[model samples]
Structures are given as C-alpha cells and as structure tokens.
Target: MNYFELHIGDYAEATQHLSILEDGVYSRLLRKYYASEKPLPADVAIVQRLIVAKSKEERAAVEAVLQEFFVLAEDGWHQLRCDGEIERYRSGEPERKAKKANEEERMKRHREERAELFTKLTAAGAHAPWNLPIKELRERVAALPAIVSGDEPATPATGPETLQVGEPATAPATPATATQTPIPNTHYPDTNTQTPTNIGINTPLPPKGGRKRSREPVEEPQGFVRFWAAWPASKRKESRGKCAEVWVREGFEALADVIVAHVEAKRDQTDWAHDGGQYVEAPMVYLNSRKWEGAEVGAMHQRKREVVI
Candidate 1:
C-alpha cells in the first residue's frame, strides 16, 4: 500500500500535544507500517534504524510515539488504525475483481461491434475515422449504409453545402438567363422595401456571438497507435485522451519503439505485476512524470531500441 488516506483533523488532534520531533517520528512510522502493509518489528533498535533515528532526541521521540499510538503483541507493534485500514483493503478485493471482469466484458463487446462495422466499410472501399470517439464512430457506422447505397441525399458540390452540417441552407441561385421570383426574407420579415442583396441570400448570419469554427478530428500517428497497442491493459490504464495529448505534445512518436520495448520489459517487473496492477502508474502519469528516464528502465535497453525516426 504505497497510498493511504490521512484525516488531517483526526491526526492533528491526536498529535497536537507532541513536540515537532515526536510528530515527525510518528508520521514516518505510520508510512512504513502502511507501505509494508504490516505491523512494525518488536525490536526498538531495528524500528529506530528503519526511520533513521540516529540522534538521542530522535530515539526518544520514537519511543514516546510508540508508547501512545501502538500496542505490543507477540507478533509485533500493532496500530489499531493501521490494522483497520489493512483489513478494509483486503475485504474489498472480491468487489475489485468483479468490477475488472465487467469492464473486460464490456470492451470485448465493443471490439466485436467495431469489427462488424469495419467489414462493411472495407467492402465499400472506405474505413472508419478512428480519430473519432466511440459514440461518433457508432453513429457514423449506422449511417454508412444509407450513404453508400445513395438512399440518402448526396452533399451538394459547392457554396453553403461545403460548410459544416447544421448550418442553415439558403435558396439556390437563379440562372442568369431565366426569370426570377422574389423570395421573402423569412428571418427579417419586415422587408418589402429591401433589395435582393439586402436579403443576404448568399451568406448566412453568424450565430449569436460569432461563427464557430468546425473542429475536425485529429488522426493519431501510426507510431503512437502501435505504442498504445503494445502497452498492457490494467486497472491503472486510465485517462487515455490525456495520455494521447501528452504523447503528441512531448513528440514521443520519435521514441515510440524505445518506449514500447521498455513497457514490454516492465511486464515482468514486480511493481507493475504486484496486487493485480494496483501500483501500475496511469498512462497519463507515466508520460507526464517522464518515467522512461527513471533508473528502473535501463539506459542500455532504451538506447539499443532507438530508431532513426
């Protein structure tokens, strides 16, 4: 358990009577206990050395904190609060396992649906815009049949039709040689005196504040996609959108091969595998913290795998 919740009010009230040195010693001991997920050793010297209590004052502080906050039993020095937290964590293991199983099943169903859609698109000599979110992709997939079969009206070749969908359509232009009918301005209805130009037929008015620029989907690079596919799916694999953003911002496409190799290597590492990936860093966290440079990943391994691109 590398992480634990500390209630500030509860902690402060309990330790307010202790000196600064004693307070620091108490905090250190609690961290060690939670990290190891066990009670402190029976031997006081061993405990002191673990917290680096070298000086006489430091040693006394350790003793004082232990006396008030912990109880000695045959196994070790146990703190009731720490014990309760450990028990609660263990008790929730079954619930966590079930949740993980459900998520895996949901992902499997999505893959099957996507595969069916891909087949249809491929037959039509088209492919999905993988850059779009799943909801948008699903909608597009459903509409593809009507579009490809010509049952749906084709998009107009030019003018306002060229703009994004949902923009208001205008009256088609009249041929220069033909007689024209005067169409009333529906928007500005009090328009008997206005000329055709004043009707603003060619250009639509900007939406309330201003025209909103269309935001097209951004295509992800092949390198980043491969890197992501190679990365393991775990409980900590979260914030995918933010992770993709960071990958591009950091220009990690150049280091994709090296990064993927390191991730493969770490598949066997104890920290990532421990407690079913409870300690695995989130994808966004791994990129943001630049963990590839950490000593845990060898320089030799990364350098050997670096590509020219």
Candidate 2:
C-alpha cells in the first residue's frame, strides 16, 4: 500500500505523550511501515536503519516511540492499529479488483457489439443507423433477413397452360413460326448504323464518354487537418496516423480548445522554446502522451509571470 488512513483524533490521542521529535520519528516509522506494507524489524538497530536515524537523539526518539506504540510479535514489531488497517485494506482488495475487471470486460463487449452492428448497417446501405436510438436500431437490424453470400433469391415457378373442355391440344410450334423471334445470340445488332460488318457479335461497344484516366483523390477529415496544421512540426511525423487513432479513440474532439490552449501555453516555456523549439517534443509524441489532460491554464499564466520576473 502506498498510503494508509490517519484519523486526526486517533493520531492526536496516540501521540499525546511523545515530544515533537518523537512524534516526527513515529510519523517517519509509520511511513516506512506502510511503504513496505510490513511490520518494523524486531531489532532496534534494524529499525534505526529502516527509518534512517542519524543521531543519538533521533535513535532514542525512535526507540521510545516503538516501545510505546508497537508490540513484539513472531514476525516482527507489530502495531495493533496499523495491523487492523492493513487487514481491512487487504480484505476489500479482491472485490475492488473484480469490479474493475468486470467493468473493463463490459466496455470491451459493448465496443465489439457496436462495431458489429455498425458494419451490418453499413453493408445493407442503411444511412447511419448508429445515430438512431439503440432500441429502434436493434429492431430494424432484427427485421432484416439474414444475408448469405453467393446466394440468390428463389424465382417463382409458372404452371403449364390448361386447355378448355372439348378443345384439341395443339402441337408445339416451330421456331420459324413462333410469335417472338429469338436473337441470334445475346448481342443485338445496331440497326441505325450498320457500316461495320466485320465487328464480332461478342465485341463490346466503346463507352460513350470514354474511360476515366484516374480515380478521384480521397479527402481527409477537416478536423484532423486543422489539428495537424496547428501542431508543432518535428522530424517524428511518421506516427501521425497512430496519434490520430488515439485522438479519435479518446474523443479529443470535444477538448480541441483545451488542447490548443495547452500547446500555445507550452510554446513559450523555457524547456520547450529554449533553443528555437529544438527541445520541444513532436506533435505525435505530445498527443500520444496526452499532455493536454493535466495542463492547467492558471499554471501556464503563473509560469508566464515567473519568466517575466
């Protein structure tokens, strides 16, 4: 444990008998105890070393405090109050860890489920069903028939024509006398312009406007472009894609102004601008480390005052 509870009333009552020096020694010993998450050593010399006691008076203060607050046990010198607190902290750890684990798993499952739903909706050409209410979107998704690749819809079957009573059944007609003439092949000859007799029946016609020479370029998102323009440039530009991924993942869009403010504030700092921004970190590195998360507007103003003075 990095920390432990210190009730003011209990602390005052426990140390009322000790001098100021002894009280300081006691506090240092408690810190060492919690930091190690174990009891003090049984040997006074070992305790002195653990608490880094330097002088004869300091050692005496430590010894006096230890005797008053701690009892010799099988393991070491144990304080009843500290032991109780350790027990209470340990007893609740498993439940707290389990709760954290459960929450992480739930979030993972939700992201996966949402991604799957979004993919299905997009494939079906539904226009942004993800923006709809969860219940309604789910209902629409459920109403769609299961789609299987490489499968076509079934065609309706037609029944044979029936003859009236006492009417003779006619023989099958010849192809020449049939009501409709079947095209020679799948291709239909051009009737309007017939100069090209050498053209094969399977030859495809030229496109009306001609084939496009190149594909249109894909456009990047305007928000990301703006952010890139504002960020400080450096040689480490390769990680821009990764930095953008993290930004979108963490929802930095809502904090755009805050991030800009942090960047502008840091620009004038001694460490960042010491040698014409040579010491400044790359834009990608800054974004990846989430530097803006802890930046304080007030702290920046204070630093500005300090620099001026």
lDDT against the true structure, per candidate, is 0.71, 0.65
Residues 16-93, candidate 1, lDDT per residue (tens digit)?
999999999999999999889999999999999999999999999989899899999988899999999898988988
Candidate 1: 10-residue stretch with minimal lDDT: 300-309
- Model 2 alpha-carbon drift over 4 Å, by segment: 103-309
> What would you estimate as the lDDT of candidate 2?
0.65
TM-score for each candidate, following the candidate numbering: 0.47, 0.46
lDDT of 2 by residue, 86-144 (tens): 88879999998998799768757654554455445545655332234445556766766
Q: What TM-score should be assigned to candidate 2?
A: 0.46
Query: Best by lDDT, which number?
Result: 1
> What's the lDDT of the predicted structure labeled candidate 1?
0.71
Candidate 2: clashing pairs of residues: none
